[model samples]
Target: MRKALRLTALAGLFMASFAQAATPIDVYRDPNCGCCKSWIKYLEANGFSVNDHVEPNMSALKQRLGVAPRLPPCHTAVIGGKFVEGHVPVAQIRELEKHPELRGIAVPGMPAGSPGMEMGQAAQAYQVIGLTQDGTDEVLASYPASSTQ
Candidate 1:
């Protein structure tokens, strides 16, 4: 009985530490949007701990977070002290984690095949934009015609 109890306690400690090791991502989105929920699920599935915030004024939230007014998406997230706007891919998210110098990353506008915006055969080519806190922007990654996700 004592051996079983020790093993159970050890397992609990391992689970707790594993959870703590996950990066925490805070997502803000409109309450009425279904795509936002899908995006949150995508993040969670990719090993991110998500904190969802149902926001009524999305534009205001974007403005305060340093996301350009021109770049708009169904949802926005704050991860690793940087802003992530739109349906950014898991690979790109991992890239940002590896390089914390970037101020933010974004996929402006909703394109089908993206994590939340996906539908059947309607995906469009899009670029993942990297932005500095100063408002300067560049294409960090691009999804071609064949793969929009």
Candidate 2:
């Protein structure tokens, strides 16, 4: 009985870990950006299944998707009905999953220390902004910038 119980607990633990892995995220980015690739790698390392699409005209894509210019970034993603921009933290993405009403999230410009943008030792200060369907935005979280500048 003891051995059976231990096996059951172990199985449960494994299942829990699997469930916590990041979900599928469709990321659209410019083909020439190195930071964008790094960001994709970050998501993959954290369990996110990414379907990456490289486009030369990211501006047109953004415009069609209703993304605000002020919140633009090196990449864009659509996951669980929320649009994600830039090197957004995996934790924030998970949090957004809980709020189904949000239209999306944006990190704006490529600030240092943001996932793939990390450089140097000092982190830059940046904000993660959430947008609604109509284009209004709200500050969701603030993170330290990349060390490189």
Candidate 3:
């Protein structure tokens, strides 16, 4: 009975730790951007602990982070030292962890119906672009438009 009780306690502890686990991400956004705040709330809901930073000059910040001037940058985020630009979904963000060869991943522009940019089920088709270590862009994931729209 004591051995069984010990096993159960250990299992419970493991599950507890797993449940409390959260990925830490630092988000930099312009103070005037309302959508960025919505994105932060979405991240928190998806088990990410956000370290929010309001930057006055987002252009300089994005440039310093290696984000290309061509990409539509609403906000910039760092996850495990990799840049995540624009409104990237949580699933693709998790996939980024598996590919160390990628310098970072981005959604480019704010697409309607993305996590924070939801517009009553009107989701626009978008692709998650990944910047490789070799400095080439690749499509990592594609989100289709919602049929309900």
Candidate 4:
């Protein structure tokens, strides 16, 4: 009986972790951009399933996707009806997933130390900005860029 309980507990733990996992994101980026590829790899390594779309006309795509000009980045992603722009952290993406009402999230420019943009121990201060369909935005969180201690 004890062994059965232990096995059931283990199974439960495994299922819980799996259920909490983040869903894959479909990313659209410029084919020639190395930074965008790096960001995709970062997402994949951190357990995000990436669907990459390499387009020659990234600007046109961005505009069509309704990603604001002020929040342009190296890449853009859409998942569960939410748009993710720039080098946004996986954790923030997960947070956005929980809030179904949000239109999208953006990091604006590529800040040094943001995931694939890491540069030594120095990190840039950047904001994860949230947006609405009407073009309103608000700061979700301010993340410091840093890859090393």
Best by lDDT: 3
Model 3 scores a TM of 0.84
What are the models' TM-scores? 0.82, 0.80, 0.84, 0.79
Best by TM-score: 3
- lDDT digits (tens) for residues 50-72 of candidate 4: 88998888789788878888888
| Tens digit per residue, CA lDDT, model 2, 17-74 | 8867648999998889999899999999898989999888999988887788888877
Summarize candidate 3's per-residue lDDT along 1-149 as a digit string, tens digits. Answer: 99999999999999788667978899999999988999999999988889999999998987787877767569899988788999899999888889999978899788998878986766899999998888889999999988562
- Ranking 1 against 2 by TM-score, winner: 1
Model 3 Cα displacement at 10 (Å)? 13
- With candidate 1 superimposed using the best TM-score fit, by how many Å does residue 83's alpha carbon deviate from the native? 0.7
Candidate 1's TM-score: 0.82
Clashing pairs in 2: 112-146, 113-146, 119-148, 122-147, 123-145, 124-144, 124-145, 124-146, 125-145
The parts of candidate 1 lying over 4 Å away from their true place are: 1-17, 98-101, 147-149
**Lowest summed-lDDT stretch of 10 residues in model 2?**
140-149
Which ranges in model 4 have alpha carbons more than 4 Å from their true place? 1-22, 145-149
Q: What is the C-alpha lDDT of each candidate?
A: 0.85, 0.85, 0.87, 0.84
